[model samples]
Target: MVIGAPASGQGKTTVATGLMAALSRAPYGLDVAAFKVGPDYIDPGYHALATGRPGRNLDPWMQGEERIVPLLLHGALHTTAQQPNPARIAIIEGVMGLFDGKAETEGFASTAHVVELTESPVILTVDISHASRTIAATVGGVAAFEEGVKVEGIILNKAGSPRHADEVKRALRRLGIPVLGVLPRDEAIHVPSRHLGLVPAAERDESRQALDALAQRIADNVDLARVVKIAMTAPRLSARPWDPAAEVHPPVAETTTRPRIAIAGGRAFTFRYAETTELMEAAGCEPVEFDPLRDPALPPDTAGIYLGGGFPEVHAEELSANASMIASIREAIDAGTPTVGECAGLLYLCREVDGHPMVGAVDATAAMGPTLVLGYRDADGTRGHEFHRTTTTPAEPTMAPNVHASYLHVHWAGAPELAQEFCDATHAYASSRPDLKHHGDTEVGEGLVDLAVNVRLPGPPAWMTEAIMATLPGLGAYPDATAARAAIAAFHGVTPEMVLPTSGGAEAFTLIARAIPGDRPVVVHPQFTEPEAALLAAGRTPHRHVLAPPFTLDVDALPPTDLLMIGNPTNPTSVLHDGEALRDLAGPGRIVVIDEAFMDAVPGEHESQIHAEMDHLLVVRSLTKTWGLAGLRAGYVVGDPRLIARLAAQQPPWSVSSPALAAMVACTTDRARVEAQLAVVRTTRDRDHLIESLTTLGWDVVTPAAGPFVLADSHDPGTRARLRVRGFAVRRGDTFPGLGPHWIRIAVREPSVTDALVEAARV
Candidate 1:
């Protein structure tokens, strides 16, 4: 495994890729597989190019490093099939610095964290062009920082000359450190960078040549034989028993029977985890593979179909050109094939994806929208996220169904009901049931014949349900209705009659839009979509002025209007506007609404507009995202008493459920609880420090990025994709209009996740 500092210009990727490439080309016929630390996609591309194997990322924050060994072993077994003697060496490229994740917490989410998880020796890559002997001091500090992270060798990059290399060697000699190699400055071989970091290797033609050049250069300078010997001497890891085939074996009675499930494979359907298909096979179902880009038909006997994630969008033109395959899959699904589509698979099932004609299976056209669709959503308890860019046509399903073909990257966290619900919905469709046609064109397949077609989706799995339910009691302990009324009275300095509780920021935004008596209102640009969407639904044009250059809000850009909406510390960019300047915009004729979704994050309540009159200044607050009660969707809007009453009338009776309402009241009343959560924000600042570290390395960071996120430009597409393969998913830059094509957004969740982000950038 190779580790480097946090930022894109770092040499971790080059070192790891070169090692893999050189090792794979050995005369011993060593078959190598690669794994990158964190949730990046680009570095894995280079790793793949080097070893002729798929590169996977190990994210401790998402799946934890425990999942790495299983994937590694599986990849090993897979390589063995290609080569009789598989190389035991699994080249892992680490994220960020050796110990720079989450906070001052040592080895929290750093490369050191995963190194400890995998028990791998580390090769520390240092940029030594400017400093020679000091490089040793740098190496010594990192080696001594953590005993668990075994820094076996150092690759000094950008060495000025032989004298400079000697100086670095002398410095390292004093510290008893081994200098693996000295790399001279070579801009010809430097990987390009963009806002999201390195562009994906698959998207670059020179990526292969770059890897080859790097490998040859390293081989010429570095002791390749010595490195190989070190790798060979590394102790073999104990076999993990997490294989799907071992955990979920089919019965002997079902030995000769074919599987009921059919999964699309090949390049188009290649994003699926091998475990998913294996799980299906173990469940007494045959998991068949088909190529969506070339297959003329689904497996003739495929009872159900699964199209996992892949790069269908990237290859949309090719997919569209293959009209025969698209038509065949559509016919099969329409004839009752239980299809489960996700990410790219979702794009394939749609009518048109990004202007290209796709299989008209799901009624919706998937367009390459200007906005990126990404977020860590609580869709099915798996807490998975979406990391792609594309918008669906209006014909898409609006609710849950058996054939859920959407961009939601769902994780199978024992949400058996979801699967069963899907199967049931599919069965309903096959039965020609109208109720099943809640949205879009429901594909009707052949009804289950001579079989019960029973599906087993585990009920909100036990452990997850406990995790989900834990929020309730913590929220339930908050103030009662009477106490909440008192807090509201204190906040607005008015009677409790003026305040009303809602579901969340969504409900608050929706209610405010419904209550406000306005025809021509303008929404500030680059804000949350809910408020503007609500206003537009109410027949309001709502002109917008997106944040201009540098993402600094300009008051002059506002459209002349009496009603204005804004998300303080905007989403996507997390830009915080000056409260004083905002107040100046609120004149006698104007009503300014602020969605302070993240105001709690900003110290000092004085930054909020709530201090102004409730009548003219509508302030919305949520205990969801801040307190991690997003699933509960609990929040409230403080405004004029008359307006609040009007907004309340627009809602159905008890629109906010008893549980949800109680949770909201409880959360708002507990000042101590809220303050306690603020302590965690310190970790977020340290994460910001890492991003600041990136700017020194030539990254163009977006300003007004104080709240748990930042935007930056990498200016290279290949770097962006390589970052993806590294287990780090950065929001693509082109999605937001004000931001240019090279811009990318990084959300600050945990310190560990941030550390991974920093590590990815350094790569």
Candidate 2:
């Protein structure tokens, strides 16, 4: 989610960082990925402090139009915390005004641009210190100003009193956006700043304590859970994972040692894209960190050097004092080692900085310029940013042998070819289940109508088919699920840690059964049988909790069990259980696992437990029934992070094929979800029609049926054979635990097809 403001001084960073700190630390206990939506690196420092994750940037101009969503998902899925875990939500602090971007580009790299690309919901933070109800008009205008930028809510910063907040809220009531929070004037909530921007949080001795106070202030005012829910409402983003290896060119290694790329990182140089190092590592380079102010020499065997952007100008005297470090750098460059410098690095490579001696590799003196040179720069198909106030006598960067020093800051994610080329130069740095089931796939024989199974689609959608076909060329590459997991997490409003994408839902059952501890496991019968079958295969005796006719789950009737499995809108019974009841079945030592493969068949999925948060509850989802990709076997389990991790450990590597992962990436987007919703509505209409027709024929169709298929008592043991003789194949009910042969499961199709099937049955 993007936490933006109408303009600067509106507390965008304060609220964003505070929220990240609060959510990650307290009552919420959520792991948050923090981001800044532009090229500036100042605010991200505080955000990193708040979240304990490397705060990243989502710059469209620098990274390119294609990489916006991929970068966001990658950062959200991977955390650098001490105890690394998937970020539950990502909070992006907007740069400058919400819509402000490049002056000539009409907001090209704005927060709104990132929000649009990632489909992230925004909570506008407006400064109410000098305004009141007009803040409402400003926010409403911002919301109306763009399409695809969803402003979910607003936070009123520096509000005067309860009355002022109430006035703004009242005015915003018509805008239909809630006032998520109101942070009153707090003098203690400010961070000290320098010329470039806010001082690096690492440089502040009391940064942690200050951030704690800020977090407490925000937590006291903001509705953290409500914010999380709004974040969850952000639509799933669709994109293939940006694989670093795929982006980097194939490496040619001559030496046994992996080339060490000495990356400048200390109080002086803190601005660097995380992906830049990632791409280098992916290309077989060992990224070594060095400090110019303190380090006596570079890392041992440093084959390359990357001097990134920072405040070298502020530390010029100290950098000059470190004569040995400067000589170390000069010797490496003179020795023809590949070295790249950007912004501050370029300034340091010059002969002098404010009369202080420097590396002197590029025979030019450098000093603070009168004006800042900054913006998006595209040269020879390369995209980068110029963000420094320093100037050199040579003006242009020197591209001498084995060295390319410039002020241009480039994110390797956008120009991966550069990362590839650079890493190849530094080449040498070493290195970077199951199933059960009474099957659901039903193929109509010759000309027969297929009412036998509950697969909603007869064929994959055109986009999904293309996605599967796209994976065909990359089948040789071992499936890397970074993109698939992130996409799936966004789709279901859960952290990637809580999701384990399997070959199919069946594999999930096998994994959970094998990994999840439950000596007293129980499977609710008359639902899908995969859970029970998997348990039996894993050598566990599960108590069968069979519901009587009419099939509403009665938890009271079941004995106490550590593991319980059921289905939403259960198969062969078509009875949808309340999510509240299912959640009630999960507790401290108990796991409530629900198979929701058919939940997509329900309009709105009102009773699905997929989005509910319970440590012991798990939801098994499948794309097979929804997208007709049973052969591809794309499915996942969203549940307790610990349980999901266990299940993931048990899953065989690459068990879910590339095509299946691609299908998962394709099926979770907002576009696919919109299409899925329309299908659900159509299915509901046809299902109602089918029930009416079957009722008229005295087949006794079940009421309140919620899945794509409806179960009915045909009142004849010969009904399955009779339907087959009439050119229709309906599911035989005897195979299900509680149902007899007289009952049949009928998949809902088009209304006309339902009518034809009913007419054939009458014959």
Candidate 3:
């Protein structure tokens, strides 16, 4: 749950950190994780002190929008790279006010936005010191400001007296909002402040004592048990924690002395990601923390120097007075030591910061700018951030010898290549980037049985070919897909407004990725990779729900998400899910996507939800597999009119070519249906024969195969190569999420072709 306020100075930080400590200690002993809403770094430090764990941030603006809930889950469930002590509950401290976000964006990165993404309950803290029933109006306004923002309860702070608290409570009763607590004004709870908000917990004198006292007072005043109930109301998430060790795959190096990497720290440089050090360790480097404000010199034998963002402008005199450290940094950079600096670190690399002397590595002078240069940045290839008031002479990113300095804050966890590349400069690491694109066509040799690809016909039938040639004369004008959309709608028994004719079934996934608004989108795996790939291309990281052996759709195992994509008579698995179960997954808050891409190949098209009237359910179909129209790229998505309109808006004008649109319209005709059913009958016979032959050879073949492909485990790791030697090509199964190399997806074909392949397998 989020601890928000009507505005700033409402005791949000004090109450939130206090609640975390109270929940984590004594009678409750409930594990608590702390999170800050925006990019502020001070409150998290105090939060860490209160919870005995690493504090984390959840800013949709800093990180990508899709990463907010995932990062929250990462911190709560994983805590550290080592996975020690997961938290039972998480409490988020909202930044500024409830609705404050990026400047002039109408609350984009606000606490309310985070709540909308996570669907967490909001515990608003209103300072009701000056007013009685008027405070009720302020709280009422916040509750009704947005339809989605739910003010579950309120914690009134700085109550002047019992009479004053009673007046606010009496007024709040009329609004039907529970008044959780009333904390009387106290100066001791307030921490010392600086220009950049509260002074960090590490720098404050008797900070631990102050926090403990604050926590006790909060426990005495507020309802701790009730707060836990509010936090529990947030939906349960099944997100896999972000692991730094898993993100970086470095070749095994000799277990000798680990390369020492100097990391900037202390009062002047307090901003740094815990994952950065974890990534360095994973990439075979020893991170040594050195303070630029106090440390006289860099760590001994420093092979790399990473200066993170902080307030160098605030402690300029102290950093400048540390002459030994400045000289060490300058000398190392002069010797071409690998070094990277960001924001404040960028300012420190200049000759002077606000007239204070500093390292002279880059030929520039740093001073305070008139306005803070802020906001998210991806202008270059690297996605980074710029949130500082300092400016530099001859400003664009400065590079000198082996030093690169810029006012961009890049989290190495998001882009591990930055860390690996930095380590590679030490001449000790190896890179082996994996490719995700699958190509069965490339696997097929010049003269092999055509089982690698799924298309039954090498080319389109005579009628589709004639249709393509006839459209060539009409191609001079812009393509129109109105006829295709109407055909798809008529065939599916849906309205034309609820039909979206796309270039291909794959393009439908791309349209959903671009148009659908969902921070939590999940793609069920061991299916086609297109949905996951499309989500990735559109700047969304989708969680893969891998099924066990003999893959089947399990809706309950799926993570909480707004957009859920799965395949029916699924691609490689060919496992058709229950239509009713698929429909049950779609409700008020979620939109279930059924990719019936191969359903047309099923005889009678059993277990299909194409005509379901559920507004939140969509069905996607294609003509590429059964009708042999892969090159023509004909497909459409059927759903509620609102969803179809959004997808159509994402598509460009005349996206579907005229010839492909003609094939789409043609495939919906009675003659096309007869041809597809006949082809499906023949394909089913071929699939049964192959399954029988493989089963006789002690192979583990998936049962009830409905599509043109059969997933079977030959129990031979070298089966693919041996088949290639025998003039047969089959799709490798390891490319899919759950299957291993021994498993292969063999395309159903003529019995004679299957006989030859079985003979080759018998050898």
Candidate 4:
């Protein structure tokens, strides 16, 4: 949950820290974690004191907004050795005001921004010392000012008298916002502060007692039960929680040595995001911490240097006195070591900072100024940079052969490629694994019957081919998908914005894997292998729900996961699950993906989810199977427009060829739809005939096949090989997760082909 206020000096820190302590204490008995919204190192120290766990920062401006939920999940799930208990709840203290951000007009780095990203409910703390009935106007304005901000409760801090508290409560009741607690005015309970903000909890001897008093006061006056309930009511976040390992690209070479990246640490460089270190490790680099204020030199065999933002101006004299450290930094950069410096680090690399001599790596000077240069900047490398509330301004970045220094502090969450690029420039780098690449296309050989593939036997009809060929003469210009998208949208009965034309069903899976963020992606198995394969290729191992025997989908039996992938009229199994059953699997916080690549083959398309308006439902359709355009690779995904935009963002430029775009448009036309319906009737009859032929040959075939294929349970492991030797090629089911070598999948064919297959099986 987020704790925010109307503005600064409204006792946000006091309420936030108090809530953390109170939640972790006896009656509550809950494991609590703490986070500070912006870049304030001091408040985190107090947060650490309140809760045993180390406090972390969640700044959308410094770290891109994409990193907030994942970082929060990481901090809550993983605890320090000193505090082994995982956090059950998290308390985030807002910076400045609820809506005040990098600028007065924009809510880019504000508490409200973070709330929108995480969907965490807010408990706005109002300093009631100055006003009573006016509190409603203030709190009501804040509650309704933003579209997505959910202010669950209010805390009236520093109330002058009982009468004032009653008045404030009555006004809040009229506004329909609950007053959770009220703190009486007391100077004795106030924690002392210095220039930088609140003093570090470690520096004060009475810090522990002070925190205890605050916790007691909060427990005594506040409705702790209601607050906990509010926190629990926070909606399940839609974006998959960030995983450091998943975000990093796999090592280029397994045998390559991990590069050592020297990261600046200590109080001088505390502005680093937690994901930075995780990203380095993921990119096959080892991060070693070094203090510029104390460490005499860089770590023994460093290959790169990462200098983050901090209060370097405050320690300019100490940094300058450490001549050995400055010289070592200079030597590393001069020797072609890849170095990235931001803000304070930028200042430290300059010739002089506030009249004090620095490392002199960059050809410029940094000086303390009255004007603050801070905002959410969109840079080339990072998604956004947060130059927090500060007084120091450094010169522009000095780009060299192996050095990149800038005054902007970039968050590496959304841009893992930047880390990959940085590591590739270093001496210690390797290539990704190649063994994981495998697909059904590899099974198809020349001059084979081609039952090994699921695509229709014959290619596109003559008219379809002519339609595609007609676009080839106009290929001189770039392919514009505007008309094609509209055609697909018209066919699917969705808006053009909800349609995204992809290269193929395979490309759709790849895009989904890359864009959708879910830690636990559940793949219902014995289906097409591409979905799980795509997830694995994206550095995520999806949870497999392999069905046995009948191969039916059970919503109750399925484990809880944020993202789910299921095949309708399942691939190999040929069972058509009820659409409502699939819809039941989707809930408030889940994303359900239905792979309907072969759904057009179904007689009535009864169980297809294409037209379902469920927000979380994503239907992936392919024009390849019914239209026999495998070589052309045409498909489209249907879902919420917002989700469609995210998946589209991950695609490369002009991913679909001009011919493929034409095929997609032609296949969705009214004429093509009527032809497809006719073909579906023929395919269904052919499938039933093929199933009967196989059953007559004493083979156990999965009945009621909806797709244009059938799965037969064969005890012989060499069924595929035997069929191949008899001049027929069938798919081996062993590669599918739930199936073994004894099962084989065969494409539906006419009577003549079925007779040949039956005769071949007799061999």
User: Which numbered prediction scores highest in TM-score against the true structure?
Assistant: 2
lDDT of 4 at 309: 72
Q: Deviation in angstroms for 15 in model 1?
A: 2.0
Span of ten consecutive residues with least summed lDDT in model 2:
428-437
Instruction: Looking at model 3, report the run of 10 residues with the lowest lDDT sum.
Output: 427-436
lDDT of 2 by residue, 141-205 (tens): 99999988889988888988989888888888989988888999888888888666678886778
**TM-score of predicted structure 2:** 0.55
TM-score, per-candidate, Cα-based? 0.48, 0.55, 0.53, 0.51
Assess the local accuracy of residue 709 in candidate 1 as a C-alpha lDDT between 0 and 100.
58
Ranked candidates, highest lDDT first: 2, 3, 4, 1
Clashing pairs in 4: 70-242, 240-517, 240-518, 252-430, 252-431, 252-432, 253-431
Worst 10 residues of 1 by lDDT: 448-457
lDDT of each: 0.63, 0.83, 0.82, 0.81
**1-763 per-residue lDDT for model 4 (tens digits):** 8999999999998999999999899888788989999766668878887888878888887667767888888888875577787888999999899998877548887999999888999999999898888989999999999889999999999999999899989988977778899999977669887444565675568889999999999999999999999999987766566776787664555544676788998767766666677788877788999999987677755778999877787788999988768877885676567888887787788888878899888878777665555556767645455453334444544456777877776667667777777776654411221112335566677766777677774688888899899997899988888889998988878888888999998899999999987766788988888887798677555666879877877788997788999999898899888898888776678999999988888876888777637577788988888877888889989887778898999988889889999898888877888998888888888888898888887778887788989999877888888887778888877777778777888888877888888888987
Candidate 3, residues 36-69, lDDT tens digits: the string is 9876667888888898877888877766677777
Instruction: Quote the positional error of residue 477 for candidate 2 in Å.
Output: 60
> What lDDT is obtained when candidate 3 is compared to the true structure?
0.82
Please give the lDDT score for candidate 1.
0.63
- Which of the two candidates, 1 or 2, achieves a greater TM-score against the reference? 2
Residue range 389-482, candidate 1, lDDT tens digits: 6777757455223366766654331232344444343333333311211211111123311001000111222433354465576555542445
Model 3: per-residue Cα lDDT at residue 626: 76
